[model samples]
Target: MSDATRPRLKVLAAMSGGVDSAVAAARAAEAGHDVTGVHLALSANPKSFRTGARGCCTVEDSHDARRAADVIGIPFYVWDLAERFRRDVVEDFVAEYAAGRTPNPCLRCNEKIKFAALLDKALALGFDAVCTGHYAQVVTRPDGSRELHRAADMAKDQSYVLGVLDDRQLAHAMFPLGDTETTKEEIRAEAAARGLFVAKKPDSHDICFIADGDTQGFLAKHLGTAEGDIVDEAGAKLGTHSGAYGFTIGQRKGLRLGNPAGDGTPRYVLDISPVENTVTVGPAASLDIHALTAINPRWCGTTPAAPGPYTAQLRAHGSETPVTARLDGGELHVAFDQPVRGVAPGQAVVLYDGTRVVGSATIATTQRSTPGPSGA
Candidate 1:
């Protein structure tokens, strides 16, 4: 479509009071589109705590976003999304941990809160698209389907976390930072040049709802601690754990096992059985898995053909490995081309075709495949 024939789009930019989001709003306004800035208040009561210049959804963050919006000559608003964020992201994170799974709150926030809920609200308000500072791209294929691709900056690429977005959501999404071959420093420089207040602010990490980086502490405080038994793979009692939620697959430290292995080698957590109130330990090699099962799979577009080999990453920063994936019933079965270590349940398995994200699903279980005899 020619620029003259195209609609004069109204874009809603989700500003997080960061340099990246500030630059994103600026870029959107410079693109000749009517732009508005929105800051989602995800915390239950943001006014209770003094806002910091570096945190997300803080009172100071709202102020920073408002300043950016003013500089960009766009209207600004703060939407109270605390209730939805609690139910969709925070509560789900706690529930997943209570069930002995390590959940990614960022992914859940993007899937349920930002892209799904916020996108719906923007569309209802007559906005043509919603933009964010996420470092991922939306490309239109020859078939007119929108494909999610990695950002130009590999270190800041966020495609894995955004793999849950479906095609329709991608169609109405904008990522101005995706095409920029600039680093965080450069973005901050641009913001500083524009005299934006958040130019020098540090990035926020960890679960946003959790005050500190204490996942176990947060779980214990909310869910209450459940003492459990730590045992060997054969179900023989080896030690006692403070809580099952505190442990994860392949964790070798903090076991506090009173007994050592027969070979005097340190053992690792191979599995956690919540029903049995036990954490199984064995040789570290036992953490290797050749195959895994995942449920609630969501593809970027339609489901791809089964029995196709693709690249899969177990975690956001994890290395991508070739795998053969197939849909079985309602679950996804994936067999790695090579053995992978520490394949934990509850982590996301993101599938990709080169730089394009295909889909992602939560890992349900992992199993070790029997090896062939030597010299076969």
Candidate 2:
């Protein structure tokens, strides 16, 4: 947010009943904003989501958030966004897998649900900014343009998932926890000091909608089971599987192949063909990708005018790899300095300039051959 904005602006804090978000709402209220806490009810069947104390996006989580809001002296409300989440994130997840690709539901939630749906409503309700616990900084340049950057705590930085946020979103976004150099331990301590009940709550690591963390089973239930052939790069049938959507690129376990490779080396899933209902397995080296094409580019600040040097992160928790990328013909093309493994279609490719997030796109295709440093 720009410095020119008023100090006591109306701020909507998204409280997920997590320690980080509780602290974030408290911090925002302390900062003198007219902060109001809100918990997003993302599932129609709340019981179908994770229900234990450690679970998120559930009835228990909403209770925790309401109690935290009372302690923070903010009005609390629950917004039922179950239909939107089902359409944008859940359905998209199933369709991506059905199309022989892997999708990150967490990242998609941040994009379609958190920023798009939530932020839009907040703006319509006269809120000056929407605040969250995401560990990413919004830096305002001299020209007053906002840029999204990594947090001081590298280990907990979430800029990769927030890469889907565009420049407009950055303008009205407030991350109370991002600028701090404090670790997770410090944050928890702060929450406890502030009398937040979620201080010691275990962090949720599973997909909120998939309560059991059984992704294969979830996909099978949604996409249905179909007997398919498991094949190799040479079009030779290696085995058969219940469904092609059950597997993921670069998967190395539960292949259930009839026999091991000729060299007795474990093979990895190199490709999935939904049309052919087949999964291709090969040596690990076959999973290395040198370049890829991405679609639906969303820039955090400004779109790059030309190809340039930058670093790319393929997964939310993945390390940044040196890359050269550019946008052309409505697609983002990126070339890695060294081949990286396990990059899959339907996953986002977030580009960064140093600690600042440039933008992100949905990966569509991967190539084993390099496309030159400029991705020409």
Candidate 3:
């Protein structure tokens, strides 16, 4: 197709009734592409006042998205994805906690619900691509491969949560906010200037499906109470915990220990044993790890011929540390360049090569090579 005659892309903007998504739809429409606004209904039991206009799946949000679509002169629709979201993201989150792992629900929602399920549905409906407000960029390399990169706004970079998307998804995706130099405040101001309904909306913080940020309470309510013993590294009973699902790696507070160590130091949760219904506490040093194993890996762009050295990020805003990552029997093994702390299993480990996202996996286990100090 010639440059001018190239078919105008039919894009579906996943609006969440937020300033970011609102501006994204505006920008897409201004670019002359055929645009549609879609608000995903991922919550079935909505009780919050901010449901539609504030959270990801409120009726107010649907109306706001529809308003944005009308303002941009595009067709708008709401897709009920609650069943899939609950099954793939929420249930998996509970299961991960029950297994003593810390799950990143946002990453799960992006991988399973948004990109995988929503993308399929959009494509089946004849949309050329699915666009969103994700603060990430897709670049076409000289070799003609699509590469995922960090957005210009470092503080708002969302590549970590998007690291699991493969090339097929990347091919049919648009991130309109990727190149925008606007901050959240600026976006909100722009929305106000445009008289948008979500101009004064507060940002969503807690998990959308969960009523509150009480993760432990939510897990207990869903998975049933499994009270367990809180022990030290040597398997000495320190105290009793309410449940194994309540604790995560590197957590320091809420142990409820009546006494301190002999050195007057604090203890941290180092491991959780779901099988034994126990949580292991030790000095902060025990949280240090030099290597980790990850299962169910997904490589964006293209898979490396052989895994070598790369920088791995353990958290969304966490520092990128040097590590040697290799694919072993469909799994990923990452050996840190140095001992790193707070290497929690169940969190995402995203790998990168400079600005390009290499791939990512969920941390399954860690192997520590050095013993930590005593009574630390």
- The candidate scoring highest on TM-score is 2
How far residue 212's Cα lies from its native spot in candidate 1, in Å, is 1.5
Give the higher-TM-score candidate: 1 or 3. 3
In model 3, where do residues sit more than 4 Å from their true spots?
1-7, 48-55, 371-376
Model 1 has an lDDT value of 0.83
Q: Kindly list the per-residue Cα lDDT of model 2 for residues 186-210, writing each as its tens digit.
A: 9999999999999999898778888
Task: State each model's C-alpha RMSD to the native.
Answer: 3.7, 3.0, 3.1
Q: Is candidate 1 or candidate 2 better by lDDT?
A: 2
**Model 1, residue pairs in steric clash:** none
How many clashing residue pairs, candidate 3? Answer: 5
Query: TM-score per candidate, in order?
Result: 0.93, 0.96, 0.93
Give me candidate 1's TM-score against the actual structure.
0.93
Better of 1 and 2 by TM-score: 2
Q: Rank the candidate models, highest lDDT first.
A: 2, 1, 3
Candidate-wise lDDT, in order? 0.83, 0.88, 0.82
